[model samples]
Target: MATSTASYTQNQSILDALSRCIAACEMCADACLHEENVKMMVPCIRLDRDCADICRLTAAFIARGSDHAKHVLKECIEICRKCADECGKHEHEHCQQCAAACRACVEACQQYAGQA
Candidate 1:
């Protein structure tokens, strides 16, 4: 009964949010790796990588109008929120920025994820 032809890419705001989050996640991971206490940042770095990868995949699923787009978005929201929470624990500028981006992505994903 739902519109199965939806194209995620057509939603500029969501696409932009996802793209920004992906970039932020990558940057955060790199910054974490260069921190003096890199070992302590292992969890953040791992989450950042995971968030970025999932964001990218979610975007692709949406762009292709996949039947699984809603499911992908739901997963993306969970990871983005987790990543944001982890980054929020750090005081680094990169982590702060990453957290902001992750929050934005979560907000965007929430709009359509419930339809899954």
Candidate 2:
């Protein structure tokens, strides 16, 4: 269910990926909060929040065509990978969905970051 950003500039794909990752992370964090064993989900929740925040910053940098956007994208890919791995460890549907989105963002960012 990846969204198409073909009409946008090449870097726009990275923005689209970040947007998806942010939404997914937010949803996953909320879902983790509602889990019966909330204590067990602390790491996942923290990662999700961190990932979302980073993704937001990365997207803003990219949107503004800042020189530092490349560095941000590199950092973003790392956080996205960590968030995806953490979410993948959970059985919740939202976690699973978030993991997929994070992974997608990782790939997109990595691809664009290389060109940056």
Candidate 3:
């Protein structure tokens, strides 16, 4: 039997959030590298990359309806929160935007976890 379309459709919100978070994180990391005091943004850049990777993995797991999706989402939530915290410490527009995206992704992951 074919997999239900509902399986993929149900995760659309999280998928969208993950995509946004990935974009924001990549942009933020690149922007941070160009900052005057790049040394100060190391933590933020690291977290952004970490968060983006985890979000991508989680999105993949959820999209395939993998049994590991919930487990990966737990990690995604943690990393997203950490990334947001690090980005929140920065004053740059890209960092702020990335922080917002991380926060949104965290919320979406949590909601999906609850439903799963």
Highest TM-score model number: 3
Q: Tell me each candidate's RMSD, in Å, in order.
A: 3.3, 4.6, 2.0
Query: Candidate 1: which pairs clash?
Result: none
Q: Total backbone clashes of model 3?
A: 0
Question: Which residue ranges in model 3 land beyond 4 Å of their true spot?
Answer: 1-6
Q: Between prediction 1 and prediction 3, which has the larger TM-score?
A: 3
Identify the runs in model 2 with alpha carbons over 4 angstroms from their true place: 1-8
As for candidate 3, its clashing pairs are none
lDDT of 1 by residue, 1-116 (tens): 13433543346567789999999999999999999999999999999999999999998887776888887888899999999999999999999999999999998888656543
Q: Each model's TM-score, in the order given?
A: 0.88, 0.91, 0.94
> Model 3, 13-81: lDDT tens per residue?
889999999999999999999999999999998999999899889989988889988889999999999
The worst-scoring run of ten residues by lDDT in candidate 3 lies at 1-10
Clashes of each: 0, 0, 0
lDDT of 2 by residue, 1-116 (tens): 23335425676788889999999999999999999999999999999999999999999998887989888888898999999999999989999999999999999998887766
